[model samples]
Target: MKDSFYKYFNCNNKEELYLKLKQNSIDTHKLGKYLKFNQEKENKKIVIRGQNKLFDYLKNNIPDRDEVQIIMFNSNMEVLSDNKFPINTQFKDILDKSYVETANHVILLSHENEYNKLLRLEMDFKLFGYKIIDRIELDKNLELDSKNGIGNCQFTEEDIINGKNKNFKEEKKKINSKELHEFMDYYAKNELLGLNIKDDRKKIKEILKIANQEKSQEYFGLITYNKDQNITNIETSLFKGGIREAKIDPIIITPFLLHQDTDGLIIFHNHPSGSISPSQGDIQVTETIEKMAMRFYKNVEDHFIIGKNKTFSFREEFLLSNYSYERSSNKELSISEKEINLKEPVKNKIKSKEITKEKSTRNRLRSRGQER
Candidate 1:
């Protein structure tokens, strides 16, 4: 029997297949969770090397001892589920129930001949965004059969012992904090700042009011690193109107990347006004983060203000010792403090009508609004 057809559709034995997955993890620089396969095609099917629920599920559902068909899905490429279905039924019905509707790709694992037929059959399903095997590479280890069908074999301990020499250590170079920070800076300025913090309708309405006024509350993030500092990371729990309260602080914006070992970090946020000033709120937030960093034994090296222009950092004005210039560089205008002229305060007018009420009422509102 031609096992190559099966190996082609699926991977080697469980351990070997897992090793291949590990290799893919190193090659693609992705988490193992992203690796997955479609077991319905040959020379391209995902082989579940170990016996687990997924393997059992495949075996139980596909009683065709000689030729078994399977399908699987994953977050990064890891098999989340290895579901099997009857070949007699249409594949679409199986997919609709087995995989998430948002799946970007579909895998097919079967014998070489069957895969060719599937390629032809899959054209009709393409309209539904069902991306069939984007690739079809041969598996030399699994020999092809001129007739019969593909062989779906199980692994024994001997297979792993045999393939030991093929294994190699993963070469991962350590990145310095500066490089990590630079990477974060680029990603945040280009992609991250655009993300709207998840907010409810009431919160969104409040932000919209500020946004409409051209002075929308801005967001700021700080990434600090120091050789001696123990606090290597700090983040604000939530943005204004983002549902953080005295009992529950807002969830800090998740960093796109974290390199705790290198003691490096990068942070950024949106400028609703398109300006870059460190507002009173911004300063308070920074101070809070700085304090948190100190508690964690990490340094608060720089606070970044991301907007239409480039990202601004607190380190730029460290020499100036001028909070006003730092705030201006961030495109944030101070509303509470008097202007440079000192004759009048900057137009830091409270935009919210509720905030404009009596001092007692405003105090109550402010108290309720402050992040815990």
Candidate 2:
């Protein structure tokens, strides 16, 4: 490494090294052709020893394929100009600070399908485009794995009596502005959710769309269920938190699970930033709740991450296989609904009353070769 340029010249920082190279003739000193600065795997210095690493690898070394390149600058890692990117589903949690709090490596994300050409124009028409989705870092003195929603988050009079180091914090898990307005709305007249916002993809998506007015913070939600997977409750205020994190501690919801109507749970939270992609924190909390759910001979049904326009379903995207789908504790066939004359009545497959247009008009339109 004596062949290094900085070693030959008695220079310190990159500025000095640059000035020296321009002033002196490199051919006169006869430096090595294969030139590179001093770089070691675990060097303690933030930059460099002989000189500073003004030439960071990621900033300088990305491939020069303009077709697939995206340039971004950041003052702090908290916010970015970009909100979403197509990345591997497995590494979704990597975006959450709890997973890899302050990573010092480049995060390279790619497309799941090569022919995912639906957004060809929106993605700058680069079918093979690449995006670096880095971690969301906290402000201040760079707290390691910072701004988390775990461990004794809320303060109480009990903490004061016990002389705990906790301070008074806002109780996040409560019905707030959204629900208050809803309660004051037509629901006061028992107009219970006039639309079907209670099951499947539509349920999570529509509910979030209505409740996602607060884009500045996150709201951890829970959909409680009985042993048979029948939902008992769905509340948004399970725990509200600032952007980038929210508490999903199983202890907070343990009482809910103990209830006779609630043996299972489905946990979720909103990405106030409008990205439906599940972060590492989301997965970790889901796993944490699932582990505790197993104790009650149950499992979390799904985790629905609410975005601005979409909802990311853990059960749908990752698949139901990773979870305990089959419950051996299910009741015997002797207790079937048919045996007790409690069988549900089958109605017309299509309920025309719910349809806004009259069936006669729709049929007439269809008869007239309506394209729609």
Candidate 3:
């Protein structure tokens, strides 16, 4: 009653077949190894198709490290797509072209000279992607005369961390008289000692004093306390040039009256050139002052050799004074003091460093280690 014949269907499964053809002609079964589409449609030319949106999903969600592949199946479970074009081929371009996929970030590797140009470009691209730029290293490969050149590379992360840029204006705020005195003290202690001052110690001192006096007309003073704060003591050193009516830097010749309890001292003078050196006459005047200071109970501590950064200070070294003073013999002085029953002198205590909790915390958290 029936002839042996192959059957072909236009639909892939019973659901599609029933919906499209109004009939389910074959039993549905899950083949273990392959999806075998058994049909007698060799002459009828039936076709099966998958959703194109499946490719869009794969392109958008592929993992960073994995590759994607396309699969094809025939009626008898044969692979129909050509294997030559691997599914992973040009997958990167596909993802790159997709608006849904994006890179995590980008890095800039150009030199300082190119930084501005690159920065502009980077800003433009930042709307669509992420990026990081390197800071210029100023110590090397920096060109002179360029504001944005690598010359600025000397700045450190500490400079940024400390908010140097933000605090610049405040750091240079107007200074007070008390601060000026303390700064002078520190400067004298550190910059006016030893061999550096031995030759011109007296002269340097006189000059500094002139620079500090209220009557000084030409000299403007700048001194720093501790390390961060600055103080200025304004004075006129002299009238500029040979104009007789123009007052000249009157050489400061103040007597040393500081007590033994004084911590430090610095004296400076102004040269019309702003030079901080002693003239031959200045030297003689300084020597005379030194002799007078020793006569009293005072110390001629430090002399600054000022000239911008060309400045020098003898306090960094030790120097023996050349002058000899005639005084009462030590035995005679001792005998005179021994004869009197003297009441004990009250001791004055001075706390030089004020250690605040903020300072302690800052010290503890500083990137550097404590000094040995």
Q: Say which candidate scores most in lDDT.
A: 2
Candidate 2: tens digits of C-alpha lDDT, residues 248-269: 6667888876776665666767
lDDT, residue 186, model 3: 37
lDDT of 3 by residue, 1-372 (tens): 221111123334333423432232332121100111111111232222322332222222221112222222344323232111222345244324322222333222222334454455346435555332222112223211222232222233342233212221122123233333333333333332232333654444433442232122233232211111111222222223231112323233331123323212234444444444344333443345445455553334444444421344433322213332222231212212322222111000101122354477788777465553
lDDT of 2 at 198: 34
TM-score leader:
2
Model 2 TM-score relative to the real fold: 0.36
What TM-score does prediction 3 earn? Answer: 0.24
In each prediction, how many residue pairs overlap at the backbone (N, C-alpha, C within less than 3 A)?
A: 44, 2, 30
- As for model 3, its CA RMSD to the true structure in angstroms is 37.7
Provide the TM-score for each candidate, comma-separated. 0.24, 0.36, 0.24
lDDT of each: 0.36, 0.42, 0.31
lDDT of model 3 at position 46: 21
Model 3 residue 201 CA deviation in Å: 13
Off by over 4 Å in 3: 1-275, 291-302, 306-321, 326-372
